[model samples]
Target: MFATKYRVAGITALAIAASVSLAGCTINMPGSTSDSNGMMDGGMMGNNQNSSGFSGSDIMFAQMMIPHHQQAVDMSTLAETHTTNPELLALAKQIKDAQAPEIEQMTGWINNANASMDMGHDMGMGGMLSDSDMAALAAANGPAFDKLYLEGMIGHHEGALDMAQMVIDSNNAEAKTLGENIVKSQTAEIAQMKKMLAGM
Candidate 1:
């Protein structure tokens, strides 16, 4: 009877330990809470990518940056038709080339998290240009266009760097990798643009 009781006790202990371990794992993963009515905020859905180890910050970074990079690509497209300066043209091409792939990559990250990409109109952070500013840029041509493109893009790149840095603590390996790449590449591009603007 003593031996049977010992075995039962051991089994109970193992079951309790397993439950505790699973609880710890659940606590460590990112999670969202719903309202008392059980309705979850749309942003919360975008912020939680626990399946991929992504935190809220990682999701925010990717979402904000998608529109921001799209703006850069749009501005770069303007430069193609509006500017005569070879340097400005080359820089515009480079911006589009680098950011297009990044935009796609960030989109994948957001989708992987099952997050909504439609983050609404006010998603602008860092140094995002106003719509009026973009309109003015579109209206410009020749040296004026070059000047505006260089200045505007420098600000845009700064914003990207800011977004990337904000997600530096993400546990998601892919998000972290993209963030690091943005910091390194955009920093160099920003410096190069500064030099070009000064020379012009």
Candidate 2:
């Protein structure tokens, strides 16, 4: 009878140990409820291939940049009607072409991650034109418009470069790649715009 009692006790101990191990594993699992909720609270998602590798900063980078890029695209569109300068027109088109695709890509990343598109605040994004500034740009024409466009875009590109630097060292591969591209392309465009401004 004592032997049988000891055997039953051994079995009970083993069952308790197994339960404890499973509880620990569940807590650490990638898609665990607690862990996932925490990530989501920080503007990140969990369990999906696209979101699994993203950090909070990666998600924030994508979220904030989408609107910033959209504003650039809008500014470029304004150039079509406001400027007849061939160089200004061409540069405007280049900015639109480059940034429009990037906006779409960043949107896709946010959607895939199940993050909100809205950043819920201005984020103090540098170089964004105020309503009055945009109104002035829209009202100008010819050489006046060209001057404003070059100056505005140079500052805008510089702002983007600053934002990109935040994500350049991201652990997420996609975010890092995009950040590097922004730095490279915008740096070149900034130099080009400065030269155009000087010539004008």
Candidate 3:
């Protein structure tokens, strides 16, 4: 019994020593950074806050959504041309007027930026409409157009909100502030659209 107890104690001590050795080995591995550098290299610390991932989330959301808003405006304009209903035409006009100026506002910001950049919508985060979605909008009219428009725009706004949050999370002050503004404005607009959809 004493031999058995001594053997178990020895084994336990060996195991602990081995674990400690392994931990030190891991920390001292060649070119393996410790602290923040280790966190950075491991992609375990967090995404960069200053680089692409660190850059303002607002700019990212806006650039991607600029083209998206332009597409919506274009769809609204087309709907106005094909529809005879004053209610629908007026709604389409409102969409065009509101989005056209926003598109200009965003593009002007980009043009004024210190660098030129593009967010390939292929990245899956741009929140822009797919080609099929635009086609669906193109074929819709009257109440149908309004329904599609509301549904699609709601989704579009949600996408912008999603991208905007990324900027906020990344910790860019300007981006974060703009992202908050977008969230507030868009959430309100989405509620308004729900009411409009219900009326339709």
Candidate 4:
């Protein structure tokens, strides 16, 4: 009886030891540390503040600006073949060069979000040109085309200003910087356009 009791106690001890060893090995398994660290990093990035500390407003700004910039690019393309003014041609090229990359940057911003929703339609106050207005611009040529382009772009830039102001107070650094750029650069362009129109 004594021998049997000792044998049973030994078996129980071995079982407990085996469980402890397994637990320790599980935690120290190859790649476990790296996997945990990776998960933590991903979690941090998924937060409202990404690597650049972007906010919901920033994402929305990017998404909305994409289509807006596209329209501007399209308008500029129209001017390329329609206008003979050297200044207008230069401005059209400038608009295309500046806005095309911006669309790509904004796209990347939206894609970084885990499940970003479409916020482009929620706030449509930006002075988007009407279909008739676009049609008018398309149908115009020479001095007429130049006038329509200037007027349409002025209104379009004004809409962008409104949108930029809406997000000027955003906590996201990139968004704030982009907003400031829009305000300053577009403001200057608006002034330039006004002067050109006056001259015409």
Candidate 5:
């Protein structure tokens, strides 16, 4: 029985390895079709071996990023509730508008992947914020608040970039698309934030 199991595992690996040579590689794995149009093929699927849903790396990336994105949105929300500066308020609204949809998208991916919703269950990085961090942001005001907010947001964006790179490094094709997008978006945002911080 053990020998038979090993043989099955070896065969599975062989099949997967062989599929690497197929055209439109990233989104197209064997045992899958791209619908009526050939153009719709693997480009969208990202070379997945499993048809049921997301790869493990993809799931991990989604779970971790959801909370990380949420934190950025959450911090931004604080500015609306707690600040008076028009400039700072505008920044807060921008962060909230941008990240809120991203949080939803990540959440949808986690659900679609058949992954657990309880981020507490070792779901990577989407855990709740610490009480102290919340208080520090809450108490800040004026340029001091703007400086802290920008600094804090930069760290938050860095965390997202780290998790995104984790997905890219894993080479989960479908997830890599999302990961690459995150890298592009956050890197730009981080640079922008730094410029704002320097002026402050």
Candidate 6:
């Protein structure tokens, strides 16, 4: 009878040990670390995952900003063929380089959230060039192109600054970070563009 009791006790202990081992594995799963709120830590997911903490505003900002950034990139591309000014060309390249990656990052956020890419209707995205404006830009070359491009982009960047400010106060960490970055970089660029405009 005593032998049977010991055997039963041993089995219970082994079962508990196995259960704990499995639990440990789950807690230590790769690429997941929970904070006190049970939300995943930012470093673990790197803004790629759409955490529950994300708000509607976060998604809206990303969706709207993607197209906004795309326009800036398109405008920059026009400079390559339209302007021979070294300063203007360099600035165009800088805008393209900065905004293109941001477009991809925002796209990833939208995809992760299973959100629609479409703005669904005209949200009156600030500083977007009209089709006629783009056509005018495409047709122009030399100093005319440089002046138009700089002025158009200044307005575009200002619009982006407004949009970025909307989300800077949001609770979403990723969105807030992007917003701050936009405000900082674009603010400096705006100053530089103003100085460049003054020269011309």
TM-score of each prediction: 0.74, 0.76, 0.57, 0.71, 0.65, 0.73
Q: What's the CA error at residue 131 for candidate 5, in Å?
A: 2.2
Of 3 and 6, which scores higher on lDDT?
A: 6
Tens digits of lDDT, candidate 5, 74-154: 788888867687766877787778778877876776655444644343222322345676688789877776777777777
Candidate 4 — worst ten consecutive residues by lDDT sum? 1-10
Per-residue lDDT, model 5, residue 142, is 70
lDDT (10s digit) by residue, model 6, range 1-200: 11111112222332333233222211122365778744444322222334444554566667668988998999999999999999989999999999999999888766665556774543535677778888988999999998888888888887787677546876777779999999999999989887898899
- Model 4 RMSD vs true structure: 23.6
- Which digits, one per residue and each the tens of the lDDT, describe model 4 over residues 59-177? 55565677878888999999988889999888889888988987887777666643243442424335567677778889999999998888888777776776675357767666777
Pairs that clash in candidate 2: none
Q: What C-alpha lDDT, on a 0 to 100 scale, does residue 112 get in candidate 6?
A: 65
Cα lDDT, model 5, residue 145? 69
Scored against the true structure, residue 38 in model 2 reaches a CA lDDT of 43
Better of 3 and 5 by TM-score: 5
lDDT of 1 by residue, 44-157 (tens): 322344665565556666666788789889999999899888888888898899889989988886666566675443332555677788899999999888777778777777
What is the C-alpha local distance difference test score of candidate 4?
Answer: 0.64
Error of 1 at 184 (Å): 0.9
Task: Count clashing residue pairs in model 4.
Answer: 0
Best by TM-score: 2
In terms of lDDT, the poorest run of 10 residues in model 2 is 1-10
The C-alpha lDDT values of all candidates are: 0.66, 0.66, 0.53, 0.64, 0.58, 0.69
For model 6, the run of ten residues with the poorest summed lDDT = 1-10
Question: Model 5: how far is 20 from its true place, Å?
Answer: 26
Per-residue error for 167 in candidate 3, Å, reads 4.1
For model 2, residues 115-151, the per-residue Cα lDDT tens digits are 5676555452556677877788899999988887778
